[model samples]
Target: MGEWSPDTELDGYEQLVFLLPEEPTYALEPENSLVATLVRHDAPRYPSALLYLHGWKDYFFQTHLADEIDGPGYDFYALDLAATAARCGLSSSPATSRT
Candidate 1:
């Protein structure tokens, strides 16, 4: 993990990627390896934080949900779990295939 960098998927935000060790996922995950993303505002304004996590075969792209929810004194963030492995060639298996 390193400094937050601009997220290619969405504007007005930054992201950090963590390369996790390979593990058994059965059908839901890829055996080649895994990755996770932590996305946050380039400059967080609130002390209170809110984190959103996307499910399998999904990545965080919606920013309005964060804008709307962060109004309640919360700094919004999102976690994308192994959602980009296949796209980036980190995993050889299909990211969306359950079987």
Candidate 2:
């Protein structure tokens, strides 16, 4: 896992990038890599939390939504699907499985 860094795209948010081994799509590459970006909100209003996921071809950039949830005593989080946002340059292919 990579170290968490300030998410320049979204204010008051942070992101981390990590890679996972997967079955390769090409013979030349023994292992395909899945790059994941975890986006998080800092300074929650309370211990409770809410996780938000963006749809296909989308990435998490809804700061207002996070603000709304965080105001209600809950932390906000989002998972940018592989090949989106911070993980964009890591892989060109879309993820095949959700799990």
Candidate 3:
């Protein structure tokens, strides 16, 4: 795990990296492991929160979707699964059949 850092693609958003111990079949090398990226806003306007998970071949790059959710007084967060992140070059691996 790592501290939250400013998101490169989304303004006013932060990203946290969560390293998993499980073996990754999509990794380019053995040393490259699996990681899930948690994207979130710095502050929540309300107590409600929305957690989203992207499907295969997808990622958490929908800023407009987050904006729409946030406008309704909910904090929006997206979980970028390891394989998807890898497909986007956000991780060290490549896309795998497994979730």
Q: Which portions of model 3 show Cα errors greater than 4 Å?
A: 26-28, 93-99
Residue-level lDDT of model 2, residues 1-99, one tens digit each, is: 567777646677787656645523344433545556667886445767888876345567788888898776888888766644323333332332222
lDDT of 1 by residue, 18-86 (tens): 665554454655454465677787778887898887635556767888888777878888887664444
TM-score of each candidate? Answer: 0.69, 0.66, 0.74
Once superposed on the true structure, which residue ranges of model 1 sit more than 4 Å away at CA?
A: 25-32, 83-99
lDDT of 2 at 16: 69
Q: Which model scores highest in TM-score?
A: 3
What's the residue-level lDDT of 59 in candidate 3?
59
Prediction RMSDs, each to the true structure = 5.8, 6.0, 5.0
The residue pairs in collision within model 2 are none
User: lDDT of all the models against the reference?
Assistant: 0.65, 0.60, 0.69
Ranking by lDDT: 3, 1, 2
Q: Say which candidate scores most in lDDT.
A: 3
Question: Relative to the unseen true structure, what is the C-alpha lDDT of residue 87 in candidate 3, on a scale of 0 to 100?
Answer: 55
